[model samples]
Every structure is written in structure tokens, then in C-alpha cells.
Target chain A: MKRTNEFAVGLAVLLALTVVVAGALWLSETDLNKQQVTAQARFRTVGGLGVGAPVTLRGVKVGRVEAIRLVANEWVETEFSLDRVVELPPKPAVISASASLFGEWSANIISYDPPPTDPNLREALAESDQVGGDAWPGATLPDIGQLTAQASRIAGDVGVVTQRISQAFDSTALKNMQQSVKDLAEISGRLVEFAGAQTTRIDRVSRNVATTSDAFAGVAQTFQGAVARLDTATSDNQLKDILNNGRASSADLRQAAGDLRSVMTAARENQASLIRVVQQADSLMTKIQRGNGTLGMLASDSTLYRETTATVIQFRELLTDIKANPKKYLKISVF
Target chain B: MSPPVASRIAARDGFVAHIGRRSLETARALADVRTWSPLLMGQMRRLGVDSVPIALFIAVFTGIVLSLLSSYIFTGAVPLYFVGALVGKTVMMELGPVLTGMALAGRVGASIAAELGTMKVTEQVDALETLAYDRNAYLVVPRVLAATLMFPVVTALAMGVGITSGWITAVNLLDLSTPEFFKGLKLFYQFKDIWFGLLKSASFGAAVALMGCLRGLDAKSGAQGVGQSTTRAVVLGCEAILVLDAFWALVLL
Candidate 1:
């Protein structure tokens, strides 16, 4: 009975211990039952990633880092055991130590297409003892430190630009700009006044021009009347009549000039005859001076002059008698 | 010096000497593996198999409370499934083993101390020594060996119960799906977490048994001494477990 009791007790303890161990294993969730593939990757830096960190494919957990060690004192060689169910792309790329929301780091495969079916590539991959290329480092969300530094730099640049703008708008430049605007306004005001004066002058000149145009119109009307009169004279034969009258006047003038020339000739002949008579008279006067002519002798001899006077008285008496008796003294001969 | 002060100093010195002697005795007892092997089975049955019910109870309640609190606290910012991770981590790394050790300290430590104290007070221990039997090898070694060997088993059981209860609470009460709860449970779990818990539990078990035995051996004559020894065993065992837990955390983590 004692042995049986002891045996039962032993069995119970064994069973409880087994249960405890099995429970621990279950809680741990070790991949002891599942098949896993060992893959290796090399990195320059692991970025605080350690063994047992989750290996994810596009944010889904697919494996875990089994080991990490430095190789050749330069690169970190990480060996991970991925579940066989996860199919890796032919060129699967990984990002090392991507930061999570809670600041924990994880290894993530950014691309996860199926492996190439090419046998040559598969053989090469196998021979090289590599699954894919090195994972891109720092491919996670932007680091807070980097963002802060960039923000600070941008803020500094903005400050510099603001300062430059403030400096550019100093009092001197502001005053110059204000003066330029004022000058422009004053010049515009002067131009407006000048334009007004010019407009008044132009109006006066326009009125003068109108007056001149009216006078020119009168002159043009007179010229038109003169041209019409001249055209009438030319077209109506009045000019021909005037021309005939002018010719007749010229003929009459020529006839009068001939008559005048004949009269002058007759006058010239009379003048010669008169000149002969005058010469005979001049000779008789010379004889009288020398007591030649009767009148001259009478003037020169007083006695002769008395006798002639008596004779003239007799002649007078005779002429009176003839006048009283006309037929008496006159000779009537028709022959 | 005052009487009270002198007595206090003397007590402290005696405690130091007792601890040193206990350690020496334990080391010496470890050399007698052949004699201790036969007694380990009975002690293991008592320490491990007998303690499962209370350990499970504590563990189950711990899991439910952890799940409820974590769900409440991390509902919005964290995913609902993280409740399982929280419970698993707590049970495996801290609560399951530590709570089980404390329970055992109260249950097994008190009993061992009372039994040994009674034997000491009644002169049974002296009789065994007079009979040329090695008392430490026969009594202390078996108890320490049994407790150290069995504590991990109890801790593992506690861990299982705690995780299961946490899973149930998370899925049913917290509205987390079964798959999500399980994913979170296994999300951050590692083999080292279980190993570390078992190692700490083993150390705690040894400490509890050793302290109980030491206190009982040092008991005064009478019923009062037996009671005092029993109380001291539980108290010191609990203290040792916490201290060792902190030490292991510092060294391992």
C-alpha cells in the first residue's frame, strides 16, 4: 500500500511537471513544430536590432532574427529563420531596423514577390548562399532628429530672408520711392496744365483758320465768276465782234493819217510861196530903205509923201464915184 | 549601553551566525546526493503535486485581472490583442513563478518549519543525531531537493493556467478575437522568458525550504517556538524569493 501510494504520488508530480513544461512551451510559441528556412543577410549597421526581433514582409510578421554577428570587423551578418510558408521575391529587398510607432526596431521586407522560376538564377542563389541583396538601411519613417534639424534649417533661412527684406525697406530707400512718386505726381500736374494752355491756343488758331477759309471761299467765288465771264466771251462770239471793231478802228486811223499827210504837203507848198512873197517884200523894203518902193519912198521923202497923199485923196474920190456908179468904172467883158 | 540595544545587537549577531552556519550545512548536505535521492520523490509529491490547486487559482485570477486592466488602459492607443501579450509576459516572466513561490512559501515553508520545529522542541532531532543518522541529509536535503526540483513544474503549471485565463478574458470580456489574442500572446514571447522564470522559481524553492529548515532547527523549546519558527519561515521565504527575483532580473535581463 505504501509503494502504491508513493507511486501514485510520483505519477501525479510527474504529470503536473509535464503539464507545467508543456504550458511554458506553448506560451513561448517557439517554432519547433513548423519548418523554417535559414537565410542570411549582411548589413553595414543593424541600427539597434537584436536577435529575436521580428522579420516582417510588408508589415506582416513572417520570421525572426535567429542570430546577428559582425563579420570581417566591418559588416554585420544577420542569420534569420523564415517560415517556409513565406515566399520571397527573386530580388527581395529589406530595410534594416525600421522604426515602429512605439520606437521599437524591426526588419521589414519591402518587396515580396515570388522567387523567379529560372533554374539558373535559383542555382546561383543557392551557390552564393544568399537569399537576396542587402536590405536598404534606414528605410523606415523619418527620424525625429533629422526632421527637427531640417525644420531648424528652414526656420533659419526664413529668418535670413525676412531680415534681408527688412533691411531692403530701410528709411532711405523708402524716402527715395516716396519722392519718386511725388515727383511723378507733380510732373503729371504740370503736363495737365500745359495741355490746357495748348488746348486754348489750338482753339483760337482753329477760329482764325475758319475765318481764313471763308475769305478764301469768297476769293474762290470771284475767281469762278471771272472764269465764267471769260468763258462766255470766248464761247458767245463777242470776242470776235470786238476784234472786228478793233480792226475797223485801225483802218480808219490809217486813212486819217493819209489825209493828214496830204494836208501837210499842201501846207509845205503854201509855206514856200509865202516865203517867196516875203522875200519880194524884203527886197522892196531894202529898195525903200534906199528910196526904191513907193511905201518905202514915202516913209523916206516927206515932199513925195505929201504929193502921194493928194493923189490918194484923188483915188479915193474916184473909188467913191465908182461905188456910187458901179457900172461906170467896171469893164464888162465876158470874153 | 541600554539593555534593549545590547539585546538587539546580540540578536542580529546571532542571526548572522545562524545564516552562515545554515549555508555551510546546506553545502555539506549537497554532498550527500546518494542519501537524499530516495527522499526527493515524497517531498516532490508534497511540494509540486499538492500545491497545484492554489497556484492555479492565484494564476487564473492574476491572468483575468491583468487582462482586464490592460484592456482598459491600452484600448485606444494599442491594439486589443496586446492584452494577451501583457498577460503572457507577466505570467511567464514575473507573476506565475513569483506568486507560486510565495504560495509555496506560505504553505510548504510553514508546514516544514512547524514539523521540524516540533521535532526539534521534542528532542526527535537530537534522537536522530544520537542514532548516528545524518539529520541534514535525511531531512533538510530531501526537502530542499524536492522543492528546488518541483518549483519549476508548479511555475509552469501556473503559467499555463494564467495564459489560458488571460486568453479567455481577452476574447470574451475584452472583445478581442481569438486569433488576435493568440497573435499578441505569441508576439513577444521568447524561450528565455520561460527559462528565466523556471530558474528563478528553482532558486525560490531552494530558498524557501532552506529558510524553513534553518528556522525550525534554530527554534526554542516549546509550542511558542514552533509557532514563531513557522511564521519566520514564511516571512523569510517570501523575502528571499523577492530578493532573488530582483537579483536574477539584474543578471539576466
Candidate 2:
């Protein structure tokens, strides 16, 4: 009975221990039988990566970090184990440390397509071959410290730009722009008013031009009618008679003009003789008035003239008698 | 000084001497492992195998509470599945081993101290010494070995139960799926975390058992002494677990 009790207790304890250990192994995700391929990568810094950190392919975990060591006291050599079933390209890009959104860090693998062509990539690939054929050069993300520094620099640049912009928009420049806009608006208003006022004057000028053009058209019509009449008269033989009459009239007029010219010449010749005769007449009239001529004296001596007349009457009687007898006497003397 | 004060000071001195002597005797008992192996197995059955139900109950409820609180606190910024990771990490790294150690300190430590203290006060331990048997090896070593062996098992059990309960609660209440919960649970977990927990639990188990034995061995010949010893064992066992937990964290982590 005592042995049976001891056996039962031993069995129970063994069972409990086994259960506990198995549960722990399960919770810890231990898989001893999983096949792993060892690969190496080198970096300038590991960025706080420790052993047992996950190794992922495109953000999915496939293995863990096995070891890390310094190479030649300069480069960090990180050895990681990956599942053998996960195939890597001939050249793979390894990220030494990548942080998740929650800040957990891990190593990641990215496949290099078309094989890297850069010289640095070739050198890294060659170095990876020295550790293992599956190895590659690892890359690193900018850490929080670097990101914070970059952010601070960006913020400083933004602040400076804002300050410069603020300075550029000074009160004077803004006011000048506003004033220029207002001046343009006023000029536009004046131009509109000028155009409105000129419209009425333009209408009046157009009406006057229309009226003058109508008068000119009427004058042109009248001149055209006269020209038409003249043209019709020239086209007919009616102007020939008038032209002939004009020529005849011109000849007669020339003859008449010649006669009149002769008459005028004769008159001009007789003008001097007429002036002499008139002067003689004027002297006799003057002498007569002064009573110096014989005729003038005869009139003045009318009474004495009567007596002489009586004597002459007596001589006449005597001459009448002598004449009857004097012919015979004078005839004989002349022979 | 008054006479009563002088008496109190003398009493204090004597109690200090008694604790020191008991500690030395317990250290000497560690050398006799062969004689205590069978008793260690029996005690292991009692401490670990038999105590699974209560430990599981406490762990499950603790996990539920941790999940509830984490979801409530981190709901806005953190994803819902992170509650699983939070609960798993907390239970495995700190709570699982420490809480289990404390629970056992109350249950197993008080029981051991009360049994041994009653024996001491009744002169049963003296009778065993007079019979030419090694009382320390027969009595205290088994309890210490059993507790040390069982602590890792119990801690592992608690961790598994607690993490599972947290996963269940997150799935049911926080709208998290099973796969997402599991993904978050294993996001940053490591085998070293389990090892650290086991190591601390082993130390805590040994401390709890040793303190109980020492207190019982130093008990006076009265019912009051037995009761006082039991109380002191539970209190000192819990204190020792906390101190050792901090020490291991400092050294390992």
C-alpha cells in the first residue's frame, strides 16, 4: 500500500512537471526541429539589436538573430538564422534594424531584383561571401535621434521662410498696391464718362456729314444733268449752226470796229482846226465889245453914217450916168 | 528605565538570538539531501500537483482583470490585440511567479509553520531528537526541497493559464480575434523570459519554505507561539519573495 501511494504521488508529480514544461515551451514558441540556414551581414552600427530579435522577410518573421560581433574593430557583423525553406535571391538586401509602429526593432530581408549593379553593392556582396554565400550587406533605418534632428532643422527652415514672407509684405508695399488698384479703377471710370460724352458729339457730326453729303449729291446731280444736256447737244448737229453764226457775227463786228476807228481818226484831225476857228471868233467878239473894229464903229456912228449915205446916194446917181458913158471911154483906153 | 521596559528589551534580544540560531540550523540541514529525497517527493505532490486548482483560479481572474484594465486604458491609441501581449508579458515576467509564490506562502508556508510550531510546543520535536533521528533533515529539508522543485511547475502553470485567460477575455470583450491575440502574445516573447521567471520562482519557493521552518523551529511552548510563528512565516515568506524578485530582476534583466 505504501509503495502504491508513493508510485501514485510520483506519477502525479511527473505528470504535473511535464505539463508545466510543455506549456512553457509552447508559450515561448520553441521549435527545436526547425531547420535553419545561417547567414551573415555587416553594418556600421547595429542600432541596439540584441540576440533573439526576429529576422523577417518583408515584415513577416522567419527567424531570429543568432549572434553579433565586431569585425576588425570597425564593422558590426551580425549573424542570423533563417528558415531553410525561405529562399533568398543571389543578392539580398538586408536591413540591420527596422522599427515597427510600436517601436519594436527587427532585422528584415528584401530581395534584390536584377542583381545590384552598384560598385558598393558588389563590394558588399563580395564581403558577404567571405562570411557565407547566403550573406549580404545590411542597411539601417534613420534612428529616432536622426529623425528628431532632421525635424528640428525642417521646423527652423519653415520658421525662417515664414518670417521672410511676413517681412516682404510690409505695410507700405500693401498700401501702394491698394492705391494703385484704386487709381486704376478711377481712371477706368473717367474713360467711361469721356466715352459717354463723346458719343453725342459723334452722333451730331455724323448727322452733319450726312446732310452735307446729301447737298453735294444734289449739286452733282445738277452738274450731271447739265453735262448730259451739253453732251446731247454735242452729239447732235444743233451746235454747228450756232458756231457758224458766231463766226459770222464776229466778222461783222470786226468790220464795224474798223469803220468806227477811221471815223474817230478824222474827228481827231478836225479837232485842232475847230479849236483855231473858235479862238479867232473869240478875238473878234472881244474887239467888238471894245468898239475898236470898223464894223463896231459903223454901228456906233449911225448919225454920221446917215450923212455919208446921202453923199453916196448922190455919187451913185452920177456913176449910173457915167457907167452908161464910161464903157466907151474905158474900152478905148484898154485896147 | 522602568522594569517593564527592561523586560521588553530583553525579550527582543532573546527573539533575535532565537531567529539567528534557527537560520543557522536550516543552513546546516541543506547538506543532508539524501535522507530528505522521499519526503521531498511527497511534499512536491502536496505543494504543486494538489494546488493547481486554486492557483489556476487566481491566475485566470488576474489575467481577466489585467486585460480589462489594459483595454480600458489603452483603447484609444493602442490596438486592442496589444492587451494580450501586455497581459502575457506581465504575467510571465513578473506576476505569474511572484503571485504564485505569495499564494503558496499563505497556503503552504502557514501550514508548514503551524504544523512544525505545534510539534515544537507539544515536545514532539524533542521526542524525535531523543530517538536519535535527524529532525531537521526529516522535517524541514523535505519541505524546502519540495517547494523548490514545485515552484517552477506551478509558475509555468500559472503563466499558461493567465495568458490563455487574457486571450479569451480580449477575444470576447475587446473584439479581438484569436489569431490577432496570439500574434500580439508572441510579438516580443522570448525563451529567456520563461527562464527568468522559473529562476525567480525557484528562489522564492526556497525562501518561503526556509522562513516557515525557521519560524516554526524558534516557536515557544504555547498556542500563541504557534499562531505567531504561522503569521510570521506567511509575512516573511511574501517579503522574501518580493526582495528576491527585485534582486533577480536587477541581476538578469
Candidate 3:
């Protein structure tokens, strides 16, 4: 064999071996020189996350998941190796989420201080915090496929609701709604008219109130003046002299009241005679009203009124003749 | 005994005797490794090193076609970066080994069978036996050992070229960036995938060389027999490669 062939064959084998080793290390992102720190994360679910999934800090790749195992059939614990130079944020949290729409997943190391903006992510993180251990708190975001399925379900629900709405909103319901609207419009017109009438009445009432308030203010002023006068009367010594005079007048009025009481007693004793006289007068008045006695006949007889009126007129004429004739006969004697 | 029964029993005994002879040859080859050891490097050079160019040629086009095809298939349904994933995975896991093995079967297996068959038909193998030379050690062990040892090296180089070609196609033709292509390439890569492919290629190499040896040693008559053995070696080696590919996928993967 030629030395050149041996060299070529050895070189080819060496080159192939180097490619295999170097390609694996580069693709796996494993550095033999770099020191690594191992950390464990406990999760309720890993979703599409698997071994060799990239671990990122602040969106930059820092490590990869080394192994995953189920613990007590409850939690999925993922052991990962991080570059030792990476300084973990205080209160580090792990959120495993779909890295792309193609079912790729990644673990994002985040700080719990700022918290996640999404309420669901926040709740998941809170639940993970309760999984007490040295392991970092880990939460799994719903995969893109799950989100798509949920959106599809929501669309189905909306479609069903829309179909039901279309079924219920038939011609009859439309007519009923139109009738209600018409009735509402008519009621609104009537209310407007009623309000117009009430508005005038309200204006009148407001004017009356204004007048009453003015009157009440005057009365209040008068009362205030009276109160002031009363206060002055009470303060002055002249009010004491008036009170003394009032006392003396009260005694005189008391004596007069005693006399009045005696008179009332005497009147009480003559009450029967007085009542008999009142009854006789009442009888006379009743006869006159009934036109039954002589006074009643005179009141009722129109011919007697006429005859008396004629006799008075004739007597006036005779008196006039006597005056003239006596003057002529010189009958001016004191007979 | 009936004549048909006698013939059936005779066929069965002949098959068993063939199996016994093949076993003895394999045992002799192993026992006399020193006698065949020197021929191993020359065989490796001819079989593995010389075979690298053709394997790499097949791998490059396989990568380019796979990249373009995956881009077409995953156009809107999946991200463009997944083209890289498809190209990398298919080349490393299946195409790189299987295609390289088939190409080598046509090249190395046919040549081995033709050369050995010509020797057998010309009484060169008989002359060796008459001279008390162990032909299995002198001929079969070295070829099989060289093929087995070198198939992985060639496969590894082909895998590297295949991935590189895919990356170039993605960057140039698919409008994908280097980082984007590499992102998807590393997405699902496992170190064991390389080992699995190498193991399958090694098995294919052994099967192809062994089948060629068996067919060549069994050749009869003259030039026509040599041609027939060469054809059988190429056909049987290809079939063996496909069967081994499936077998490795099931057993290891």
C-alpha cells in the first residue's frame, strides 16, 4: 500500500470522527470547559417540554433540560444544568411554554418579583409556589394547540348562541317590539302634554309660594318686633306698675262678677214666669204667621190696608178744609 | 422410499451442509485474524476512503432535495425553520446511511463479487486450496473487517456534508438565515441519533461484504457466472441494507 493512501484513509476517518463529536457538542450546546450548576424545577405539567429543551433567561439561552421524571405521580421534576456564570434573578421562577406554533417548548427562567401580566400565568405561578421544596417554582403555559382548541370551542359556543338568537328573534317578536315602541312613543307624547299643564300649575304654585314666603317674612318681622317690645316691657319698672294696676282692676272685676252671679241667681228663680211670657209672645207670633188672629187678619187683609189708606187721604182733605174755614169764621179762640 | 421423498431429504441435507460450511469459514477467519490483518488497510482505502466521494455526492443532493421538499410541504402549515429539521433528521437517521450503503453495494459489493468470482472460475481459489492456503482468511475476513470498520467513518462524513448542504440550500434558496436553520436543526437533535445511524451503516457494510463473499465463492462456470454473482451481490446487498435499516429503527430507536 502507498503511504499516501494510508494517510488519506487515516485522515478521512479522523475527519469523520471529529465531525461526529464536534457536531454533537456544538448542536447540544455543551462546552467541556464551562462549569455547570444543576438546578431542579417542579412542575404540574411539562406540556410539550422534553429533555434537551432549552432553558432561557431573559430570552437568552442559558442552559438545557438534562432529565425529567415524575415524582409521587403528582409533580414532573425537571433537572437542568445552567452555565455557572449565569446569576439567577432573585426568586427565580420557571415558566415552560410553547416556543413556537410547531409544538416546540422552552423553559423561561423569570423573576417572580414583577409577576406575569396574564392572570392565568400568575395563578399558575402562585400554585407552583405552593409545591414546596428546594426545586424552583415551575409553571406550564397552555400549549398553542390547547389554545387553538379552546378558541374553537368558544367559536362553537358563539355559533350556537347566534343560532338560538336567530331562532327567537322571529317576525312576531319584531312586531311585538315595534308595538311596544309605538306605545312608548304615544305615552311619551301624553306625558309631554301632561307636563305642559303641570308646568303652568307649578308656575302658579311657585308664585303663591313666593307671596306666602314674603307674607311669612313680614309676620316674622312683626313677631320679632313684638318680642322685642315684650322684652323691653319686662325689663322696665313701668311694667311692674302696670302689673299692680292690673291686680287692683282684677279685684274690682272679681266684685263685679260676684254681683253678676247674684243677678243670675235671681234670674234663675224667675225662669218659669219668664218662660210663660216667652210662650205667650211665641203664640202671638205663630198666630200672625198663620194669619189666624185679629193682627194676623189685619196683616193678611189687603182690603183693610186699602181702606185705611183711603181714610187717611180723606182725613187729610177734611183737615185742610177746617183750617181754611176756621180762619174765615175767626174760630181762633182758645176754646 | 419414494423418489420425491428422497430428493426432498437430499435438499434439506445439502442446505444444512451449506450452513455448516459457512460457519466453519467464519470461525477460521476469526481464528486467523493475523493472516488477514495486513490486507485490512488496503481494503479500507479502496472500500471506505474511495467510497467517500460517491457517498458524499449522494448525501449533498439528498440534503438539497430534502430541504426544498420540506420547505414546500411545510410552507404555511409549519414554520420555514422546520425545513432544516426535516433535512437534518432525514439525512442523519435514514437517507445518509441507506443511500450511502446502496451506492457502496453497487460499487464495492459488485466489484468484490466480480473479482472473487473471476478468481474462483479461473481456478485461482482452487489453486489456493490446493496450496493449503485458507481462502476465507486470505480473502473474506479482510474485506468484511475493512467494510465494517470504515462504513461508520464514511457515514459520519456523509452526515456532516448532508447537513451542511441543507444549511446552504436553506440559506440561499429557502430564504432562511443561518441561525434560523441551525435553531431547528438543534431543536430535536439527540447524540444517540448519530450512533444509531452509524450502527445501521456498519451492519449494512457487513451484510453487503458477506453476501458478496458468499456469492463469489459459490460462483460456477466462467465469465457468465462471475457476472451473475456480481449482479446477485449488488441486488442482495441493497435488500440487506433496507432490511437492516428497518431492523435498527425498530430495535434501537
Model 1 lDDT tens row, A188-224: 9999999898998999999999999999999999999
Select the stronger candidate by lDDT from 1 and 2: 1
Candidate 3 residue-wise lDDT, A2-69, digit = tens? 68778988998999989999998987778688688889998889999988899999999999998899
Which whole-number lDDT from 0 to 100 does residue A212 have in model 1? 100
Q: How close is candidate 2 to the true structure, as a TM-score?
A: 0.64
Instruction: Please identify model 3 stretches exceeding 4 Å from their true place.
Output: A2-5, A114-131, A148-335, B1-24
Q: RMSD per prediction, one decimal?
A: 33.2, 31.7, 23.9
CA lDDT scores, all candidates in order: 0.81, 0.81, 0.89
Best by TM-score: 3
Per-candidate TM-scores read: 0.62, 0.64, 0.65
**TM-score, cand. 3 vs. native:** 0.65
| lDDT tens digits by residue: candidate 2, B1-253 | 9999999999989967876776677678778777676677678777766666777888999899999999898888888778877897899889999999999999888988999899999999999889965788889888887888878878877888898898888888887898888777766677777889888998999889888888887689599999999999999999999999999999999
> Could you tell me how far off, in angstroms, the CA of residue A48 lies in candidate 1 after the best superposition?
4.8
| lDDT of each residue in B1-253, candidate 1, tens digit only | 9999999999999997988887888779778888777877778778777888899999999999999999999978987777877898898899988999999999999989998999999999999899977889988988988888888878887888898899888888978999988877766767788889989999999999999999898789599999999999999999999999999999999
Give the candidate order by descending lDDT.
Answer: 3, 1, 2
lDDT tens per residue, model 2, A225-307: 99999889878966887898999999999999999999999999999899999999989777777776886676566766888
The most accurate candidate by DockQ is 3
